[model samples]
Target: MENGTNTQSEGKDPSGFLSKIIGNPVMVKLNSGVVYKGKYFTRELQSVDGYMNIALEKTEEYVDGTKRRSYGDAFVRGNNVMYISADS
Candidate 1:
């Protein structure tokens, strides 16, 4: 997990498929302590450029220590992801 580095090698499952069971909408925990809820999309198991692609649709919410914040639809790339978890 390099800072601002999106260099993923080939033959690697960049989507972290094993973390999600059936490609359902899950809570993805990012390195920034932000929990993003979105559906899993296609992954590149062998790509040097684009490692992963998630069609994430984030929501607007308010935290305890902060005011309301908003998020929108995104075509999130691979390097932006840290880890994913299914929302059970």
Candidate 2:
């Protein structure tokens, strides 16, 4: 019984994955199929549903005639994220 329950618990809490690399770069994929790579800034683990907020710094390119900079905190839904791994 215990063995079966343990298997079911795998990947149950989204925080577990993020906790491992809290201060490291973790891959974040948006619902729009956009991928972002940046160091872990901060996270809110006290939320009702364990919502993890992460700040990512990455370059942004515009289709206009000029280049611009982009960086900010992204409110990521725990379930929306596909995978999280150390930047390495």
Candidate 3:
């Protein structure tokens, strides 16, 4: 078990899974339940100093399954983010 763990860690890229999705279109959901879609730009696998920076080409603020507003070309701070996934 110990050997397996070590081997897995050694083969893993330090940049992690996020590296595969950089510069791709992604959908980010914030803790407030707001969703944003845009081209991802961050290279860091994890948030930097507890903050994830994202560039948004589109944004949707949701309330009760409805979009309250929409916009384009915005920057989002990480603290509000809940999760991010590659957009199809």
Model 1 lDDT tens row, 1-88: 4586655652265344444344465665555555566544434212323444455555432244343555665454557667655666
Q: Write the per-residue lDDT of candidate 2 for residues 39-78, one digit (tens) a residue.
A: 6654443341545545544423222324343455545565
TM-score ranking from best candidate downward: 3, 2, 1
| Root-mean-square deviation (CA) per prediction | 8.8, 5.9, 5.3
Worst 10 residues of 2 by lDDT: 59-68
Query: lDDT of each structure?
Result: 0.50, 0.53, 0.64
Greater-TM-score candidate between 1 and 2:
2
Q: Which ten residues in a row have the lowest lDDT in candidate 3?
A: 41-50
Q: What tens digits encode model 3's per-residue C-alpha lDDT throughout 7-80?
A: 55543442444567866777788898777777654543344333566665545555656777777666778778
Q: How accurate locally is residue 72 in candidate 1, as Cα lDDT from 0 to 100? A: 65
Using lDDT as the measure, what is the rank order of every candidate, best first? 3, 2, 1
Greater TM-score among 1 and 3 belongs to: 3
Clashing pairs in model 1, backbone N/Cα/C closer than 3 A: none
Q: Model 2 has how many clashing residue pairs?
A: 0
Q: Give the local distance difference test score of model 1.
A: 0.50
